[model samples]
Each structure stands twice: as structure tokens, then as C-alpha cells.
Target chain A: MWQLFTQNWQDFLTGFWHTILSSIIALVFSFILGSGFAILETNPNKFWRGVAKVYVEIFRNIPLLVVTMFFYLVLPKVLPAMNGFTAGTIGLTLYTSAFIAETVRSGLQSVGTGQMEGCLANGLSYWQAMKNVILPQALKITIPPLGNQFINLIKNSSVLAFVAGMDLMYQGDVIASNTFQTIPTYIIVGIFYLILTLPLSYYMQYLEKKLA
Target chain B: MAIIDFKHVDKFYGGFHVLKDINFRVNGGEVVVIVGPSGSGKSTLIRTINGLERINDGSLIVDGKDMTDKSTNFNELRRDVGMVFQHFNLYANKTVLENIMLAPRIVLHRPEEENHKEAMRLLEEVNLVEKANSYPHQLSGGQQQRIAIARSLAMKPKVILFDEPTSALDPEMIQDVLDVMKLVAQEGITMVVVTHEMGFAREVGTRVVFLADGEILEDSDPKSFFDHPQTKRARQFLSKVISH
Candidate 1:
């Protein structure tokens, strides 16, 4: 098992790099999209609120694989086909954003209306009130949930492996098949994931305690 | 000239009428106290001045601008109108000084040094200079309300509205909040206060507007409205409120 890791180190490294890239890209875009939808969910306009509600329900309820498969298999019919990495990242981003939207929306709603009223009455515009006053307070309440969603996104990025996206799990599959070291290769993949998520999980726990 | 005018205004929440044909005007520099029983629309009436609540029918003018007009920028009007809620509603994430400085910095675009200087002055005005660096959660209810007052004053708003400002405070804390309010009244800023504090009303209020069941039962000087209320609703309200 040790020799297998040493020999297949380059493949593992490639997978790790791809996984990191996908997670980072998905994390950034999902946060922006989720936060945007969250704001729209809280918007006073009924139509926009409806749109947000539909988007959140659709993406959140759908299976992650189905969403990724749609992009990989279905999207090619209409638009130029994207590579597996692109399709996987987009699906993960959209799927994770639904949960993030729910998390952020709850946080936004939890902030007492008084805070927004106070900011508005103090001459701040709606956007200014949200940006400067409401979002900051909401963010404090959302940190723990958002942290969980981020970790989930990193784990879910493994969905990329199913589509030949060359993530850590994909490389593990390649090595296990070639070398027949299935158990050890899978163990190493699990360990690699722990390296990324464990510290984050601990950091979020610490934050929750501090805020509490 | 009237700074806030409500001309036959009507407001409803679904089928429930909240403010019925409200016809009243608040002139510049006058302190108007609006007192009523619960659901009497005291808060709603004052809120309409800043476009916080929309009037279903009729014209409303504030600070030489017609609020009911769709083209009117409510945010610009808000710069001239400030409000202190029953709850302090200070930004929990911001320090006390930041609470005061945020608007002038972001909204009014006041330079940092000038804004900081003004914030310290307002903190002095609220007698909370020492607590400038403290967060809202760190302050007592009275202190937080005082800082909220300082935050509104930072905008130099032409009119300030208080919606049952002390109703949410502890009995002991109420007096401190009222004292700061008195200081604000002394500055000759136009104020519309919805308070149950009769003593503050009798003392600082130039005019008293009595509301009951969404109607202006009486609008008179504080002395007559207190001593010789015009309508039976006003009389009954005063009796019920004063006895308790």
C-alpha cells in the first residue's frame, strides 16, 4: 500500500489540485449566488420572492447527480458541450447554493425588522442598510451554517469524480483498478478529505462557541 | 411652513383600516405628541411621514416634498426625517461610535475626520462619550437608546419621530431615555413622538394629537388635551391610561 501511494503520487497530486480548484470556484460562485437569492427571497416584491422560492426549492430538492448529469448530458443539446470539470463545478455550485440560500435567508429573516427600519430611518438606502447594517448582523448568525455548507460543497465536489472530472476520488478509482489496492487507496482518499474538512469543522465549532 | 402634512390620508392593512382619513400637519420646529391606545395607529401615522408606511388614499407632504408621489425619493426624505423605535435597534455588529458615524459616512458622504468629530460630539450630547468604543450589546437599554438617538442626530434630520420610544425600556431606564429626548426637544428639531409618557408629553410637547380606533379624536395643546379633552374617547383613554 505504501509503495502504491509513492508510485501513484503524481496522479494523486493532480486529483488533489483539481479538487482544490473545483472547491474554490464552486465556493466563491455558490456564496455569491446563494446570497443573491437569499436577498431576493427577502425582497418586498412578490414576483422576485416567488422566483427565489422556486429556484431554492427546485435545486435543493433535486438529487446532486441529476443536476450534474443534466449539465453533462442534457446541456450539450442546446449549447456547446462543457468538459466534465466545468459541468461538475456548475452543478455542485448550483446545488450547494440552494442550501446556502436557505441558510442565509434564515439568517437575513432572523435579523429583527427593527434593524432595517432603524437603518432606513437613519437615511440609509435599502442596499446600504442591507450592506452596512443588516447583512453584517445576519452574517454573525449564519457563520456556523455557512461553514457547514462550505464543507459539504468540498465533499460534494467528489461528484466530479463520477463524471471523470479527475478529482481526488476519480484518481483513487484509477489507481485502485490498476494496482488492485482498493482498500488502501480508498483509505488514503478519505484521509485527504479529512485534511481539508476537519480543520474547517473545528474552526466552525470554535466560532459557534465564541459567538455563543 | 408645515414640515409634514397629511391630507385626508387613509391607510389599511388588508381589510382593517389603520389610519382613517387622517388630516393633520406638523409645522417646522414643533414637537407633536401622538398618544393613543394600542392599535390606534399612532406609530403608523408618524411612520407615513417618512414613507415607512404608505397611505392608501390622499396626499402626504414632508419637508417640501410630496411623499405619496411615486417619483419622490423616500431615502432623500429620510435624510430629513429620523426615527427612534420603541426598541433601540442599534446595529449589533457596529460599535457605539460606528452606530453614530455610519450614516453620515455612507449616506451623507461626510468625510471620515469630520464624521468622527461629529460622532464624538453627538456621543457627548447623549452623555455617552466614554462608551463610544462599546458595542450595542455591551450597553444597557438606556445607553443603547441614547446611542440610537445620537445615531439619528448624526444625520441632522429636520424631523425626528419617536414610536413609543420608552415603552420597551425598563421603568428606571425610561427616565434616562426621556431625558435625552428632552435634550433633543431643546434643540428645536421638529419631532413627532408617540409615547405613553404623559409627563414628557405635558412638558415637551407643543401640541398633543390624541388617537383612538384609527381616528384623531382630539388635536389640541397639551394643557387642554390633558386637562379638558374634547371627545369622550379621549376622556376614556386618558382615564384608563392615567389610572394605570
Candidate 2:
């Protein structure tokens, strides 16, 4: 294990950094997209609700590898050519957003219907009622589920490995192949993932407690 | 002029009729109390005034604007008519003060300083000035309902609807909410209250409306309605309610 570290520290560091960057970027974008779609799903208008439903169903049903591969192998043929990292991040964002949307929609529903009626009766427009009264309560209910979706998103960023996106898992595969030390190399990669995820899990628990 | 007028109104919940051929009018400064047994459609009748429940047939007018017209913006009409729910639906995320300040600031576009001042005044009216910064859950049921009342008052509405406001309160807490409501009534704000509290109906209401099976059986001054109820149902309901 020490030998693997000494031999390929630079590669491991670069992979770790890339993984962190991609996850952060995907996390932010997916949150925005997921929240938007969740709001759309909860909207009274049939058209917007249908659009959100279709988006969530399509992305959530497909496998993560398949989604990543489409962007990596299929998208470039239709649009401008994109690199592996960008493709993987986009795929990760879209895939995770579906789960997030579902979690958030449940949260919105958990808030009593009276909350919306109260705001409307107080002269708020529908959107205004949603933004001011409904969403705040919904967010509180969604935080625990949202945290799980985010943690899953970070782990799922490993899909980049299949496309040679140079993330931590990709580097682990490369190192294992070249050094023939598969078990140790993978162990190191697992440790790095724990390093990223454990704090997030603990933080989410803390947040849930504080909010409760 | 009447602040709210319902002419031959009918409302149906699918196959079940909720309100039937209701002809009701709330004149300015009149406190109208509606009393009925459970499932008698008292709530449905009051909710229609602010467009919370849409009437299936007939014309409904609020503040002189025809609520049945599709072009009439319900949000604008709601600005002049506020409602307090039986559940005391204060915003769970907001402080008591923010609950009062939100609609006025966002919907009315009241200047912040003016809005804040009015919110404080309203809070004082409800006797919750000390709890302005507290969240809804932190307050007791009576306090929460009072804050809800203050929130409705912040809009300075022409009419306020109270839908069984005291029904959810503790027996001990009921008086606090009723006191605030009584003050609101005395100030001449047109009020439509649906309640089981016979004392409030007789003392605070200018007129009492007796409803049964989706129709108004009696609409008369509180004295006549209580002392000389015309209908058998009204007499029976009054005896049962007043005895408790």
C-alpha cells in the first residue's frame, strides 16, 4: 500500500482533486435542476407537472453507466465534442436530479395543504404562496432525503471511471492495471471515498438534529 | 353596500352537493355568525367569499367585484378579504411578526417601515406583542390563533372570515382568542364567523345564520335567532348547543 502511494502519489492526488471538483460542480447544478423540477411537479398546471414527471421517470429509470455513456459517446456526435469529465459530470447531475426531485416533491406534499390555502387566503399569488410559505416548510422536510441523494450523487461520480474521466476510481483502475496490485490500490480508492463521504454523512445527521 | 353578496349560489363536491341555492349577503360592518351541525356546509359557505372554494353556480360578488367572472383576479379580491382557519395556519417557518408582515409587504407592496409599524400594532391588538419573534410551534394554541388573527388584520381587509377559530383551542385557551375576536368585531370589521360557541354568536354577532343540509334555514338578529328560532332544526340545534 505504501509502495503504491510512493510510486503514484501525483496521479492519486490529481485524481482525487478531479473527483472533488466534478462532484461539487455536479452537486450544485443537480440541486438547482432537482429543486426546479420538484417545484414544477408540485405545480397545479397539468402541463408543467407532466413535463417534470417525464424527466424524473426517464433519468431515474436508466442505469448510471448508461447515462454517462450516452453523454460521453452519444452527445458529442450531435453537438460540440465534450471531454470525459464534463460528460460524466453532466450525466451524474441529470441522474441524481431525478432522485432529488422525487425527494423534494414528497417534502412539498408533506407540508399540509392548509399552508398553501392560508397564504392564498391572505392575498398571495400562487407563486408567491409557494415561494414564501410552501417551499420553506418543504425544504425543512426534504433535508434528510436531500442529503441522501447528494451522498449518492458523489459516490455515483465513480461512473466517470468507465469513460476514463480521471476521477479517483479511474486512477485506481489505472494503477491496479499497471502495478498488478489490485486489492491495495482499490483499498486506497475506497479509503479516499470514505474520506469524502463520512464527513458528509455526519454533517447531514447534525443538520437533521439541529433542524429537528 | 354589501361587502359580500352571494345570489342563488350552488357548490358541489362531485356528486355530493356542498352548498345549495344560497342567497347570503354581508353588509359592511355587520358581524355574521354562521352555526351548523357537522357536515352542514358552514365552512364551504364562508370559503366561497374569498374564492377559497369556487361556487359551481350563481353569481358571487365581493367588494363589488363579481367573483364568478373568470377575469376577476381572485388574488386582488383576497387582498381586501382575509381568512383565519380553524387549524390556525400560521406559517410554520416564519416568526409571528413575519407571519403578519409577509402578505402586506409582498402582496400590498406596503413600505417596509409602514408595514413593520402596522404589524406591531396588529400584534398588540392580539396581545402577542411580547411573542413577535417566536415561531408558531413555540406558542400555545390560543396564542397561535391570536397571531393568525393579527396576520389577517395586517392586510387591513374589508372583511375577515373566521372558520371555527376556537374549535381547536383548549377549553381554557378559548377565551383569549374569543376576546381578541370580540374586539375585532366591535371595531366594525365585517366578519363572517362559523363557530359552535353560542356565547360568541349571541354576544358578538350582529346576525346569526342557521344552516342545515346545505341551506340557510334562518337569518335573523342574534336576539330573535336565539330567543325565537323559527325552524325546528334551529330550535333543536340551539337547545342542544346552548345547554352545553
Candidate 3:
């Protein structure tokens, strides 16, 4: 295992780039979709809120692989030329967005009732209150849970390999197949994931402290 | 013309009948103190002025705007009618100073320099200038309540409402908050307060209104309210609270 990492150092370094790319893409898209869904879930109109609820349930209940496979295999048939990477990235975004919606919804709810009343009493409109006063406080309350979701999201990105996506895990499978060094190649992959997650975890901890 | 009026108001929380046929008038710069037992709708009555609580049936006119009208702009009414809650509902995310500055900046659209200066002055009035940068959690109940008062005053409203402002404070801290409010009353800003503090009522209030079981039991001057004892409920309540 030790020798494998030493020998495959260059390949391991290259894999880091692929892992980072998938994570960055997933993070940006998921946050956008997730925040949108969270707002929809909390909408005063029952119909819009119900629509958000259905979207969350549908995406969250299905396995990420199944969703990715459907996209990778089925979407191309429906609309020509959609590749594995596109399918996997889109799948990861949708799946992670469901969880992110849950996180943010709870965050918004955790803000006390008085905060809203206080804002209203001070003559701020509802949207103004939510955006300026409530969200800042809710975002603070949500950091630890949000950080956990982000780490889980990075690990979940490995599922991209099963769909023949050219992610870090796919590269690891190729290296192991060619070299017959399964344990070492996987061990290298595990270390690559550790390298990615540790710094992310630390950064989140730093934010928690700073916000505290 | 009366600055605030609640005429034949009846409020019901699902047949509970919270405030029955409430009639009161507060002229410009008159300080009215409402004293009552728990669940007597004193808070509800004041909240209706800013449309925080809808009266089931009544005409609530404040600064000439009829609150009963569905077309009335509640947010606009609230801009000119500020309320300090019993819980000292200062925005927890904001510092004491931000709590004071926010309304003036957003609602009034005042310049930043003027807002800051006014907030500083209000904080000084509340004796919270030293704690301006602190969060609400960092302050005691009395300090938080005082900050809440300053936040309401920042709007420069036509009238201010207090719903048991000092009810949640400690015994030692209650007098300080009342002192700030007494000063505010002295400044002749139209004020309506719901409180059990009969002493403060006697000292600062121009009129004293007693409520029981969601109905006005008595509405009179504080001197007559305490000395004369007009109603069975008001007399019993005053004796109970004052003896304690």
C-alpha cells in the first residue's frame, strides 16, 4: 500500500484535480438549486410550497447512482449527446440540493418568532426582514450541519465512477485494472479523499469559530 | 382630533371573546397607561393600533388612518407607530446600536450620520451607550428592554406602544426601565403603555385604563384610579399587585 502511493504519486496528484473539479461543480450548482427550493418551501402560497416539498421528496428518496444512471443512459436517448460527466454532475447537484433544502429550511425555522415580530414592528417588509435580519442569524445556526452536508457531498461524488464518469474514482479503477494493484490504488484514492475532506472540515470549523 | 382611537372594538380568539367593546381615545401627546390582569387583552389592545393583532370588530384610528380598513397600509402605519414588546424583542443578530439604527435607515430613509447620532443619543437616554456594540444576549433583561425602547424611538413615530415593557425584568432592574419610559412620557410623545406598575401609572400616566376578561373595567385618571377604586376587578387587582 505504501509503495503504491509512492510509485503512483503522479497519478494520485492528477486524480486530485478531477476530484476537486467534481466537488466545485457540485457545490455551486447544488447551493443555487438548494437555496431556490428552500425559498419555495417557505413560500406563503401553499401550492408553491407543496411543489418544493414534492421536489425534495422525489430527489432525496432515490439513490444517487440510480438517478445518475437514468441521466447518463436515459437522458441521451431522450436528448442526443448528453455525456456521463454531465449526467453525473447534474445528478449529484439534484441529490445534494434536496439535503441542502432540508438544512436551510431547518435553519430558517430555528430563528425565533420574536425576530420576525421585531422586524415587522420596526416597519420592515417581510422579505426585507427575512433577507437582512433572519437569514444572517439562521446562516450562523446552520454552519455545522451545512458543513457536514458539504463533506458528505464530496464523498458522494465518488458515485460518478459507476456511470463511467471520468472522475477521480474512475481514474483509480483504471489504474487498478491496468496495474493489478487494487488495494494500493484504492488506498491512494482513500488518501486523496482524506486530503480533500480534512481541509474542508478544518475550514468549516474555522467558520464556526469565527461566527461564534 | 384624537391621535389614537379604539371605538367599540371587540376581539375574539375563536369565540373566546378576548376584548369586548373596547372604547378609548388618546389625544396627541397624552400618555395612557393600561393596567390589567394576565390574559386581559391589554397587549392585544395596544397591538391592534399597529395592526399586529386584528380586532374582530372595531374601528381603530391612529394618526387619522383607520386600522379596520383592509386597504390601510399596515407597514406604513407601523412606520409611524412603533411598539416595544414585553419580551424586549430586539433583533438578536443585530448589536444594540444596529437595533436602534435599522428602522431609521430603512423605514425613515434617514442619512447614516443623522441616524447614528440619534441612536447614540437614545442609547444615552437609556443608559446603554457603553453597550451599543454588544449583542442582545450579552445584555441583561433590563438593558435589552431599554435597547428595545430606543429602537422604537428611533423611528420618530407619531405614537409609541408599550406592552408590559418592564414585566420581564428583574426587581432591581424594573425601576431603571420605568425611569427611561417616564422620561419619554415627559417628552410629550403620544404614549400608550400596558403595565401592572401602578406607581409608574400614578407618576407618569395622564389616564389609567383597567381591563378584565377582555373588557374595559375602568378608564379614568391615575389619581382617581388608585384612590377612588371604581370597579371590583380593578380594586382587587391593585390590592393584590401593590401589597406584593
- C-alpha DockQ of every model: 0.84, 0.83, 0.72
Residue runs of model 2 more than 4 Å from their true location after superposition: none
| Worst ten in a row by lDDT for model 1 chain A | A1-10
Question: Which pairs clash (backbone N, Cα, C closer than 3 Å) in model 3?
Answer: none
The residue-by-residue lDDT of candidate 3 on B1-244, one tens digit each, is: 9999889999899979998999989999999999889988889888888888898887888888988888998889888888999898888888899999987898789999999999999999998899999999999999999999899888888799999998888999999999999888887789999998888999999999999999888999999999997888888998899997
Root-mean-square deviation of each candidate, in angstroms? 1.3, 1.5, 2.6
For model 3, the docking class works out as medium
Best by TM-score: 1
Instruction: Give lDDT: candidate 3, residue A57.
Output: 99
- lDDT, model 3, position A45: 82
Off by over 4 Å in 1: none
Question: Candidates sorted by DockQ, descending order?
Answer: 1, 2, 3
B59-172: candidate 2 lDDT, tens digit per residue: 998999998888999999999999999999999999999999999999989999999999999888888899999999999999999999999988988899999999999999
Count of backbone clashes, every candidate in sequence: 0, 0, 0
Two-way TM-score contest, 2 vs 3, winner: 2
Instruction: Give the per-residue lDDT digits (tens) of candidate 2, residues A28-115.
Output: 9999899899999999899999999999999999998999999999988989988899999999999999999999899999999989
Say which prediction, candidate 2 or candidate 3, comes out ahead on DockQ.
Answer: 2
Lowest-sum lDDT 10-residue window in model 2 chain B: B235-244
Q: On a 0 to 100 scale, what is the lDDT of residue B148 in model 2?
A: 92
